[model samples]
Every structure is written in structure tokens, then in C-alpha cells.
Target chain A: MKSLFFRTISVTFFLASFSGAALVDDHIHGGDSHLPRPVVVEYSDVESLASGNDDVRLWCESWRFAGEANNLGPWTTVPVECVSYVKTYMTGKRYAFDLEMVSREASRFARSIQMRTDGMDAWVFDIDETLLSNLPYYAEHKYGLEIFNHGLFDKWVEKAVAPPIESSLKLYEEILGYGFKVFLLTGRSEAHRSITVDNLNRAGFRDWERLILRSLDDRKKSATIYKSEKRDELVGEGYRLHGNSGDQWSDLVGSSTSNRSFKLPNSMYYIP
Target chain B: MKSLFFRTISVTFFLASFSGAALVDDHIHGGDSHLPRPVVVEYSDVESLASGNDDVRLWCESWRFAGEANNLGPWTTVPVECVSYVKTYMTGKRYAFDLEMVSREASRFARSIQMRTDGMDAWVFDIDETLLSNLPYYAEHKYGLEIFNHGLFDKWVEKAVAPPIESSLKLYEEILGYGFKVFLLTGRSEAHRSITVDNLNRAGFRDWERLILRSLDDRKKSATIYKSEKRDELVGEGYRLHGNSGDQWSDLVGSSTSNRSFKLPNSMYYIP
Candidate 1:
């Protein structure tokens, strides 16, 4: 039985190695913390054994890539094997760089648009992970290994300590300066209105225009449909969604999508 | 001046290194070929010089990742700096593995669906890079660095020698075995109808219910608009789009999206 298991692992290693997926690592779990910190595995050391986190990390990166591509639909949580990889990514500089790259591109696109003089020109930004950082909350939780619990999450949101995703804040500021009205759209319930408002303000997000959240009736609908309907209402009110930014595809897809859409990186959780 | 140039490269290296984006390599380029072959870089060798293809390769990987995520909008060709990386990716096991991972997940989804006895249940697949590969043609071209020339490309397609994407072929076979009516919906012009049919058959694809291509009237429309119209027509005809697979987001997005959508990796070019 042990030999059979070893052989299976060996086969997996051989297959993944050719794809530049092998790794050498010191298994350094975070000290005095329940969640593991970002672990660095040396990709050049292909001769290293593949029995540990190396193989898991390779597959996790691929999984994360799939997630960001919107190719993996309706996932509930990060794969168990990928929890550490996700933690590493969310905590590491790569996550910040990925966000900055997207924001930079979005900023470039916003600059190119010839905005009309009317106040109707608008840009849409999704709240969580778009404008605010939930890394502190996710780090304390399972880094998306545990199933999402709104009850637990709401408590965190009520604390209103989520920091600004620095890059996205810059994007918001730039778009606002471009004479486009900024509309903050979120899937958060209307019940968290005061806290969400406080959270946005305290996190250095101050703006004109409106903050739209889900009402009691909107709770039962899918994120795509509810958000699409909200966008439809915005268009009905003469708002032109010139630009839309979100961490989830659900926030950017569906009817009345913007002229241009920017998808930020988020592998921790998915909203369908 | 040279020192300043070196300093800028050093700064770029430092920023990218912390993100685990560094490499060492033997600088192997393909022999006597117009398109350079894939170059292998050692990520563990961070202290190595950042002047050559190492820095380019790292950034190229990020660009390709961004492309797959649909964050890079409406690019006509691969970035000039990323031409070699794109060539390597298309020729390497990584691209194949990426395709296999997507197809594997797609197959899993296809198995989970409870198909109806009616012939109206269908799966939509885009031809290029999803059902068939233009890799040989791309390899001989500039690996998507040069501007796309439809005149040159159409001549290549006329030969009808494009091979099947082996993984997607397996997926096609698996879903077909499950009694799902297959639809080959492509952005290819209607002019290539007979050649495409022959090529598909030669490449082991058979018994598809419909091969829908762009007519003269549809040629001027953007791929997103063209595909959405076709999907709407399919839906209007009582066919339920259970699964849709394509190399481009335009093939999967817009109105009448499927119950599930799988995006295959294609960094070579973007149609719209």
C-alpha cells in the first residue's frame, strides 16, 4: 500500500515537473499563529522530493489562475490543499503587485476615455477587495479554507477596520479626478449600511455619488442577477457605466456591464 | 548613461524578485527558426543578472496570467517583450497542462448535469484553440508578436491541417458520450465551411449537430456581439446551453451565456 501511494505521488511529480511545477521548500508554518504565513518554495530545485507542499503548491497556483480567469465557476471555498498557498499569496507582495497591475491598467483606460460634461458619466467599484482589504479578517479565519459564514463575517464588518486596498484607492481617486462620478456597489446587505458607510470613510474612501447594497428582497437572488438589475437601474437613471472594477466576475458580468471592466485578483472566495 | 540603465534594470529586478519573479537560464533559442522556441529560466537564481530574457520571461508570465484572467482588454497581439514567452508557453507542457486542467474540470461538470432525453440540450465549443490548434501556424509566424494578417492566416486555414487540441478532443468525446448534442460555434468565416469540416473530421471530431460560422452579414460585428446573437438564436430554437467552452471571453460572455462556461487559455491573440 505504501509503495502504491509512493508510485502515485511519483507519477504526479513527473507530470507536474515538466510544466515547471516542482519546488524545494523549508516547511515554515507561521510561529505562534493558527494560520500559516506565506511559504516560499524554490522552483529551480526540481530534483527535490515532491512528497510535501511542493506538489500541492503547484496545483494551488494553477487552481488560483483558474479562479481568477473565471474558469472555475461556483466554488464555495479554497481547495483544502491550497489553503496555505492562498494564505501565502494573499499575504505576499505578489497579491499587491497583481492588484496594482490591474489598477494601473484601469487608470490608463480611464484616462483615455473622453468623458462628457454631464454628471451622468459614472464608474462602478465593488466594495470588498476592490476598495477595502479583508486580508486581516481572512488571515484570522482559515484564509478561505473554512466555509464562509456571514454571521462571523458580519461581526468583522461591524468592526469596520478593513484597510484600503492602496492601489484601488488610488484608482478611485484617479477616476474621481477624471470627472466621472464614483458609485460604490456591494453585495453586502443593507442591514450593514451604517457600518459599511463608516468602514468606507474610515478606510480613506470619501466620495460623491451613492453606495448601493442589497436590500432584504435582494438576498435570495444570485450576485450576478442582483448586481445586473442594480446596474440596469443605474442606466435607467441616465448613468453611463464607463468603467467597472471588481474582484469577482459576478460583480462585472451580466446585463448593463460597463464599457470597460477590470477584474482584480481574489482566489480566497468566489461569488457566483 | 549605461549605469543609469543598469540601475533601472536593478530596481525592476528588486521589485519583481520580492514577488518571486526572478530567474536564471542557459539562453537557449530555437535553431534556424523564425519563431524562437521556449526558454527555460531558473526562478531560484535571483542574484543572476536581470538584463536579458530573465526579466522579460518573468513579466511575460504575469502578462499571460493577466491575459487569461481577461484583465488585459482588446489586445491585437502578444506584447513584443513576451513573444518568446508566448512561444515557450505554447510549445511547453505548461500550456498543455493548463488546457488539461480546464478540460478535466469541464468534463466533471458535464458528468454532473442530468441531461434531458430531448435533443435540445447542447454544448457550445469554439473552434480555434478550443477544438483545434493553430499552434503550427503560430509557431511559424511571429508567435503573435507581428500584427495579425487575416490574408496570411486564411491561406493557412485553407490547407485544413490544423490538429485537434488533444485534451479538448477528449472532452468533446466524453460529453458527446453523455448524450449532449455538440455545437461547433466559431468566429471562423462561412467561407471556410468545407475545409473546417474536413479538418475537424481529420482531427477526430465527428457527428457534431451544427457547425455555425460567421456569415458575410456577421463579419463586421465584434465577436462578442456575433456570438451572443448566435447563442440567442440557439436559445430561441429551444436548445438549452448547458456547457460552453471557448478560448476567448467573447465566445462565452454577453447575452445568453450558458449554465456553465469554461475558458481555455489562448495568449496568442485576441479577436476583439
Candidate 2:
């Protein structure tokens, strides 16, 4: 029984090490190594192990996996690239470990906004990645390939097929319940208003009083300018903005006043 | 039937004559009549007449008599005092009507802001009667009171029990859908943020991104100066305000660069 257990542990370690190294190579070199790779483990497996008492299994199920017992000594530490590769791989899974962590962080951030009561009682949310998910379409069309095909992009938006992020939708509804009027400020062109409204309704987002979109005619100014201007306009009307939430750093930056910001994870992609 | 119609027409004409005479009397006396009489016909009855074609029935209804055709001729045109009394009676109802109309107008104004593509898009909306329905509560708790009881009003707001005018809620939602970030500027003290947010939430308003209340810490300034300072703050942030909506002329007047103003009906009821 002891021999069999050793053999099983050795085999698991070998497979984990080989798979980790292969993932690292795939990311760094953009080529698949012809090594027999283990099936990607679900995040749930790590969660279950988190409550268990098996040190070897725990390390194996972690974002990094040490080598076999013979090679697990101090001198045989795992490569940083392999650990990063595993983390990236885990984050890519639909039930990703990093997503859970990020989601918890997001919840904490949202609660903090709710608890504020210093005369500022408003929240600004960016539309695209912050509330709605447009990454799939962007990826399918390869929008980042040097030249942006706005006509095609507009056509995609007209379809209004983007889905809302569950966590964001919940936060939005909660904020509304809190009497913080939610303003949806999007970098999307004004031409997309009809489709945006339809999509929001379809996605079950509560109706809002203002949906500030990018101007179709003057494409000269940056989105930052447009958003900042919109923020000022709100201040002019007497709203004390307390917080802002967005996937992009640019979306949270205000022009007139300093606002509390909560960043959503979006390291997988970026939009101009 | 013909006689009845003739009698109805005669009564209307007589009422018109009496009303004309009363106007002249009012002008002559500068509205200081020794005899305390009701002003105009009850607006509710007038509304009923407008809704239906029963002129004779309306006249009869107002006078609370039937088939007294002889009594109808010189219809003392319900005194202007009667009209004033009826208006006072309908103050609550009229205010509601005014709120609905103003809300719709405000929505149209907000749309105009969204339509502008040449400059930085922004809109200003008045707080108090503009965004909230505080009149009923105020009148109910402190009838004809000149000074606002901040503590009591704050308690009312914290309860968040006010029903928002349907039209305003619709317009607020529409504006947010249009992507215009909303600012809820108010003359209320900054300490009112909690209650204000609670009220807005209770009222189902959306997209309220900024709540600019009067700072209690700062030395009191003229209403115009305070408003202008807010406007400058918005301008400094690069927002070219496209429109403004407010119950008071001062709220609209202070935002000088606003392209247009949607004046809320307040000829009969002015706050302060």
C-alpha cells in the first residue's frame, strides 16, 4: 500500500509539473509543446482542498505545483513563470479561482460605497465592461487589429447582444435600492442610444434618467474628456458623486472632483 | 331639449359677463374687495366640463341646483373668490398636475442635451420640487410655514416614504438611458445627503450621479452666487451644459450657459 501510494503521488507530481511547464511555454512562445498534458483542474477542486489537511495535495492544487517528492527539496523550487501560467490558466476557466477572489473584492468595494454618508451620495458606472460584457464581440471581430472598423462595430452594437455581468447588475440594483441614482456613462457613440436602451431593458437593468454616450459627430475628443464633462454637468445639477465603478482605469478618473473608484478585473483585454 | 340648450348657453354667457365684471372690480379695487367671496369656479368642475360636453350640467353642478333655468341667467359668475378658493382646494391636485407636466418637459430638455454633439454634453436639474415631491409633506406637516424645519424634513426624507411624480421618474429614467450623467443640485444643506438619497431611492429616480448641496460649513452666499459657482465648477470640468430644468427661475437663471430652460409651473406655489 505504501509503495502504491508513493507511485500515485509521484505520477501526480510528474503530470502537474509537466502541465505547468507546458502552459508557461504556450503563453510565452505561442506554441503548444507536444507533451502529454493533464486535464485542467476545476477551481472547485482547489476550494475543497483548502479545507483539507494534505500538504502535498494542497501545493499540487495551488496556483503553483512543486516537483516530485525527490525533486521537492529546497533547491527544486517551482519557476515563477510556471506559477503565473497556472494562475492565468485558472483565471481563464469559467469557474476561475481568481474570478472568485476578484468578485469578493468587488463586493467589498460595493459595500464600502454603500456605507459612505459624507454628503456625497451618488455612484457613476461605466457601461461597457463595468455593466455590460462586450468582450466576446470585440474578440470575435478582432477589433484591436490596428484599424478599428467602426461601421462593423456599430452594426454589432445595433444587435444589442451584450450580457450584463451578474455581480455588476446586482450591485447596480442594490445601489438603486439605496437611493443612489445610477448614471450610465458610456464611451459608446450617441448613435447607439436606441440599441443601448433596448439592451439595458432586455438585460433587466433599471431605467436611468441619463445615459451619456459619446458624440457621433465630434470624434476629436477622447472618452476621458467626454466622461469628465458629463461628471461636471452632473455637479452643476447638484449631485454629490461618492463613487465610480469601471473595468477600465480611464472610466473612473473624474475631471472636476476626486471620486472613490472600484476597479473591475479586465487584464485579459483593453479597449481604446 | 332645445330649451334646455338655450338655457345652458344663456347661463354660460351670464357667467362670462359676471366674471368679466368681477375682473373689472378686481382691477378697480386692486384685489381688496370688502366682501370676502370665493374666487373662480372650482377647477375640478371646470376640469369635468373640459372633459365632457355637459355645459348646463356643469353649471347646475357648480350651483348645486337643477331645472332652475331662471336662476341661471345672471349666474353671479362664481366669484373670483370662489375660483381662488377652488384653486386653494385644488392646490394639492394642481401641484401634482404641474409635477407631471414639468417632469415630461424636463425629459424633453434632457433629450435636447443628448442631441447636442458639437460640444461637451451636460444637463442641470433642480432639486427639491424638481426631483422630489416635498410639497405635500411640507404642507401637511407645517401649513403656511415660512421656515423649513431641517430636522423634521430630514426625518421625512430618511423614511423615504414619498411617492415621486410618475412623469419625473419616467424622465429621470429616460435621461439616464440617454447616457447623460445626472447631477442633482439642491439648495438643501449638505447634511441632507442621506435623506436626499433615501428620498430619491424611495421615489425611484435613476442616474443621479452628483448631488451638490449647499455646504453648511461655508458662509451663506446669495442664491445666484451659489448657483453660479456650481456652474463654474461644471465648466471648469469641461462640461458645456445643454439645458436646465427647475421650479424656481433662480435655479435656471444662475446656469447662464444653459442652452434652454424648462420652467416648472409655480405661479401659484413658490417655495420661499
Candidate 3:
């Protein structure tokens, strides 16, 4: 069973690599580079930014690796030295490539399982940065170096214009096609529920079993606790929780995590 | 308090980077390159390896990022296409640089805490690929292209000459200096305790609060269950388990996880 699963991924890897090459080439040389405020900033020379020393680049890469691996727990902000590095990564091809890898792995896992007729098997997804991209907002916020202003971020959220993370939307579609129920669980306050739904619908997330947001009482709790409790409630309702995807470790850690959890790369900000 | 911690890490990062540059230079240009079987193989041009396409490189790197983040689970071997990439990573500067980043962050966290007078504050570390590296053995094995052979691996372990992962050795020393009790919790069988101790001592891991190993009864258990049960025992003994570090997620996951867990980069193989 495992060998067959691996063989399928390897074959898929070849196909993805070819498609990914074209996608990357288009982004690198496309007309979007001419825009004053490009949605995805394409850097002709990534190292042109100051502090372009090899050591600094390696240090910043290592810092991101640690952050993704959850080694550096609960960091408040990107390191002052890593600001430009984060910007280049977030606004460049690497971030998209990373997401492609994660979502591919996730969809592969979801396909490997046998779906029950009862339809209890479910995949959980976090909303912001998992399904939606706040890259445009963070782009103006110095890629999260401005110390995360809630009022400013909430105003951006109220616009209901965040784009879908393309790879995640693909994963969402694949999971739905595989007959797994999709659940959108997020740390966003319930006050923004209407806008969140609008954003989700506009960004192509039209169907889900539920869109869970933190209530006033739940807002006071840490993300780990609130998300865990929400997952616990889903489990209590007899959902299998086969797969969970999130940009934050807090979304996957704590009690009642899924059979498999996929973490999307996020370097801008850390939420405990 | 957090800013002070970040400041200390930033200072340490500069110091470590300078020292790391020298270390990397020595490995790249030194006598090891001339050995019949170099201990740490250095590549003049990493792209010299076959299948060095840009897309394939990005794909392999994404695979690694997923593995390190625990998004990829329980695979027996590295992807066949990723063999060269994994080899380059394990024997190259990037792996060491990643380790430096993790250890530095871990030590920073350790330093930020006010150590209690009670000697109950403990740090847990895994043995193989965490404290002691088996790279020399894996280097001979096509960097894990060959599936794991227990007989051959046990023979290598019996030789009692595995080298210390230098960065982790430094972390062990720093944690000891900070008044934290060091506990070596490994998945190695208890039958190899003597050689394990001899190997550890030879590699400069001279002291620890305890060296916990798997007994006969533990052979049937998965690493996650075995390590978690052992950690539960430590917790039962009134130890705080303040920090944990390991190469495999199985060593860091499960019950009694530390306040902070450091994951070292290991793309060669996955252990469940």
C-alpha cells in the first residue's frame, strides 16, 4: 500500500515539476513586474537588497526553516535582519513552490484513504493564509515588520478582497472531489464572519461543511486552546478529522489533531 | 523579556556565522576532500550532480521542507529522485547552518529562563542523528538510497565510533552550563548501552542526568509511543522537561513534549 502511494507521488512529482516550471517562468518574466503595486512582487535580483551577504541569506533561510519546523516557538515578529529576506520569500516563487509541495502531499494523503459511505471523514482547514492570501495586505505592512496592528488588519479583512492561495484552493477542490467533508476553522473573530464568508466565496471557496470562527468568549483564549476545543467539538460530532491544514502550528498542535497535519509556510508573523 | 532574548540571539547569530564561515571553509577546502572516503564530502559545485534541473532542485527542497516540518510522515526512504539532493544537503554547508540556527534558538530560549535552584529543570535529547551522527555510515550507503538494513546498521553501531553532531554537542554543553539536567532519551536498544555510552563518551558527550534506551519490551512499540512513555516516566519523576531536541519528529511528538522542541534537519530518512 505504501509503495504504491509513494510511486504515485513520484509520478505526480514529475508532472508537477513540468507544470511548475512554466508557472515559475511566467511569474518571473510576466507583465506584473511593471505594476506599481504588483500583487506578487517579482525580484529580478533577490540579493540586490542590502545585507546581501551569503551568511545573512543562509541565516534568514535557516530562521524560516526553524519557524516552519516549529523549532522557534511563538516568535512575535520576523527578525529585523530578516525583513527583506521574508519579503523576497513571501513575494517570490519559493513561497508558492512550498505551498504546492504541501498541498500536493495533502491531496495525495486524502486520496489514499478509503472514504466511507457515512461521510463522517472530514478534512479541516484554517482560513487566513491557509485558504486565503493576505500577501497584499502584508505587502503594504512591510511584510509584517510593522508589528501587526489589529485595527489596520481588521480594516483590511473588512474589505473582503483577500485572494485565495491558489494551491490550497486546488487542494480544497481535490478533497471535495474525493468525497471528504471540508471544514473551515479559523482564529478570526465571529464579528467578521459575514466578511470572512464573503472573502471565502469570492476567492472560490464556495462549499464547506462549516466555517468556524472564535466567539467573544473564545476570543480571549489562545489560538491553540480555541482551535483544539473546536476540533474536539467536531470529533465529538463523529467527524473523523482525517487531515488538517494550517499556516500556524497552533492550528495543528494541542489536543484532537488529525491523522495527518500539513503546515503551509508562513514567515511574516507568529501567533501563539 | 522576549526582545532581550531576540537581541541575545541576534548577537549570537553574528558570532556563530563568523565561526561557521571558517568551519565551512575548512570543510570545503581542507584535507577531507582528498580522503579515500572523506568524512564530510564537500562539493565544489553542487550542481555537478546529475539531474540538476532548477525545477527538480526546487521540488527536492520543498520535499525536505515538508519532511522537516513533519508534514511528510513515516516514509521508509528518501524519494529516489531526491537521493542526490539529500546527499548534497546532508554533507553540505546547509545542514550545518540549519543546525546552528536551531541550537542557537534553543540556547537562547534556555538562557531566557530564570533557572530554579532545584535541579529538576531538565532538557531531553535524542541520541542518533541528534547528538551522534551516523553520516559516515550513511555516506557509504548512498546517503540512504539503499533501504535500511538492520543487520548492517547494528554492525556499524557496534563499532562505537559515530561522531557527535558538533552543534548539538555545543548545545548540550550550553544547557549543562545553564543548570539544566541533560537526559539522553534514545530509541536505541538497551543491549547496545555499553557501546552507546562508549560512543557518546568518545564523541565528547561526557555527562548526562540519564541515558534512557529501549528495552526488549519496547522493540514492538513505535518510536512515538516508546519515547512518549519514557518522557511520561521522566515527568512522573518530577522533572520539568523544559526543552527537547531531536532529528526525528517521533522523538519530539507525543505526550510530555517539552516547552520548546528543536528539530534538526534530516532528509535522508524518516523514522516513525
Return the interface RMSD of the candidates, in order shown, one decimal each: 9.5, 38.8, 14.6
Q: Model 1: residues >4 Å from true position, as ranges?
A: A1-55, B1-58
Q: Candidate 3 has which clashing residue pairs, if any? A: none
From the highest DockQ down, the ranking of the candidates is 3, 1, 2
Of models 1 and 2, which has the larger TM-score?
A: 1
The lDDT of model 3 is 0.72
Assign candidate 3 its CAPRI class.
incorrect
TM-score of model number 2, chain B:
0.59
lDDT of 3 by residue, A1-272 (tens): 11110110000000010101111111011111111211221222222222336656666787799889998744444666678989988876568668876886687688779899998999999988899988888889888666456667788999999888877887899899898889998888778889999999998897799989877677556678888999999999999999999998888989999999999999887666
Q: Worst 10-residue stretch by lDDT in candidate 3 chain B?
A: B8-17
Q: Pick the candidate with the highest DockQ.
A: 3
lDDT string for model 1 (B72-170, tens) is 655545666677788877776457557766776688678878889987889999999898888888888888776555567788898998888877888
Encode model 3's per-residue lDDT on B1-272: one tens digit a residue.
Answer: 11111110000000010101111112011111111211221212222222336656666787789889988744555556678889888776567668766876687688877888889999999988888888988888988666566667888999999888877888899899999999998878878899999999998897798999878777656678888999999999999988999998888989999988999988876666
> In angstroms, how far off is B117's CA in candidate 3?
3.7
What DockQ score does model 1 reach against the true complex?
A: 0.17
- For candidate 2, the per-residue lDDT at A164 reads 69
Instruction: In model 3, state the lDDT of residue B3.
Output: 17
- List pairs with backbone clashes in candidate 1: B38-B88
Off by over 4 Å in 2: A1-272, B1-93, B112-119, B141-151, B217-219, B255-257, B267-272
Q: Rate the local accuracy (lDDT) of all candidates.
A: 0.71, 0.47, 0.72
Maximum-lDDT candidate: 3
